[model samples]
Target: MEISSPPRSNATDLLVSTSSDISHLTELLTAAGLELGPGGTDAHRPPRRVLNTPRYAAMQARFDRFGSDGITMMCSTAGLQVCLDMGERDRVATRWAALHALGPVLLAVFANSARLGGRSTPWVSARTRAVLGTEPARTRRGAVSGDPAAEWAARVLDTPLICWRHGGPDWTAPPRVTFAEWIGGALPGVPTTEDMDYHLSTMFTPIRPRGYFEVRYLDSQPPQDWMAPVALLIALFEDERVVDEALAAAQPAVGRWLHAARVGTADPRVAGAARAVLDLGLRSLPRLGLPTDLHDEVTRSLDRRLAAVPAPHGGDLR
Candidate 1:
């Protein structure tokens, strides 16, 4: 997952595995002639693809109309997308909600990309801002419920498509024209099943659900450290005991998505919650039987970030 989407400096992004295999990933990138962008994911990256078809360029044009060239390029954000296994499809709904809320904690821990468009910014991950700010209805999540599929379907219908089908005099709809409205005869023609599927694909939320849950929000990191966040999240989700503890500790961060993007670990509460999650993640590593190198990377990352945080006036908490 390219945390740096529609990347600011380049026309391309690093295609990462949805799973965590740091060394295999390095080999793949090397083979593909791609190098991980230096340091921060969104900082100092050059200005930069989409579906093929006549609609592709039109889709890009609509994105360009909304914000920066980087955004249109869809290279402004990147993330870790860990997939939770689905047993007979209905099983993972609750976990989906858990991951949605826990997403911010991951962001707080791996908050890189302090600069975007080659300009310094206060935010740790400008990539997060670019993604959530893209189009509220689509980019930002709507309502999540116990029924993940139903909520997601409703959200897909509720969100206005970025551009209408190409045959119209103007491909853009009047502001807030939802796909449901188009299906209900508000648009001149009927919306096909294909149209519905394609529109859903454009809806980028902090977390998205397919057969597996897609955890989005952590910024793209350097190759050496990128695996830490992935390992941490996997440790939490794969182990049920850690999941409970992580969720309880991560609760305070549920709605701090925007704040996490802005102040990142600088926000004391975010740092505290992230540390708790990381600690829990560390505890699970040995039992999870993950490799030694991955264990070290996660430990080092958690220690470095938590150590950067100053001791409270009373005392050190961790």
Candidate 2:
């Protein structure tokens, strides 16, 4: 279910070619009486292997208190996460900041989930809305500052634990208890390095930093259009200059997660910012050394998206 490109390889090109395999697989499944898209109905009833696992059991137990949002997110929705290198150590802060700044625009641009539980929803990215509604403490976007590493470390320790491993069936941490409290002997056992590693894996922040940048904001794209966002992101973050330019272009929509998920590019302000970001990404694409046809495919995808919106909202990309 996952495809990883080799290190320093061209992700856009790989996605473009790999899509054929995906399409073929989809056809095979369809012939066998299977259908596939963004949403699914199996959230309420996961497979035994998935549901019976200690990790999932504990997670479900913890999320039960929050209502059905967590279950819906885990069961129904799909995402097209893009992971990239953190780049040079000195430039990490800049890249991190730029990604956060550009996140809302990206979310709005690729918003796809419009329905949940067989009912039409107001939000464009209903999956994202479900994520925010489930748990803000651990799932929301992390605060950006000059010191990302320190801020992230502190945030990790301060946030309440979802679950921790134990030999017994019950892996759920005590309600409202944080990892910091466990480290201070609030729990029966001492915290270890492995425990810290597991804790990091539990974080569901919009952008997860684990020696690499995991862009988790994007909704799963349609099969034919999957590579557009990937190419645009690569181009935007490929150079410092592009990152700064894209960040400024998307500044108007910064921190507007709810708005982006609700109205998407329908809002003139968000639409304007999205247009500029897409244009900037397009302008920077040539530097990526993509093949002519592949580059044109990306261009067409971006153009199609831009043209889909009303003129009043989608201003000229120039």
Q: Candidate 2: lDDT of 204?
A: 84
Pick out the ten consecutive residues of candidate 1 with the lowest summed lDDT: 6-15
Q: 1-318 in candidate 1: lDDT tens per residue?
A: 343222121101122332334556657788999666644444665545634444555556666657773352375445555555443445366566668767777776677777776788777777777777666666775465767778888888888776676564455555667889988887777888888777867777777766666666667677666656766666677756566677788886777887887877666666677767777777776664545655566678767876765343332212
lDDT (tens digit, per residue) of candidate 2 on 48-111: 2245777877777777688777777776777878887788878788888889888888888888
The candidate scoring highest on TM-score is 2
Off by over 4 Å in 2: 1-8, 20-24, 38-50, 312-318
In lDDT terms, how accurate is model 2?
0.80
TM-score of 2: 0.90
lDDT of 1: 0.65
Which pairs clash (backbone N, Cα, C closer than 3 Å) in model 2? Answer: none
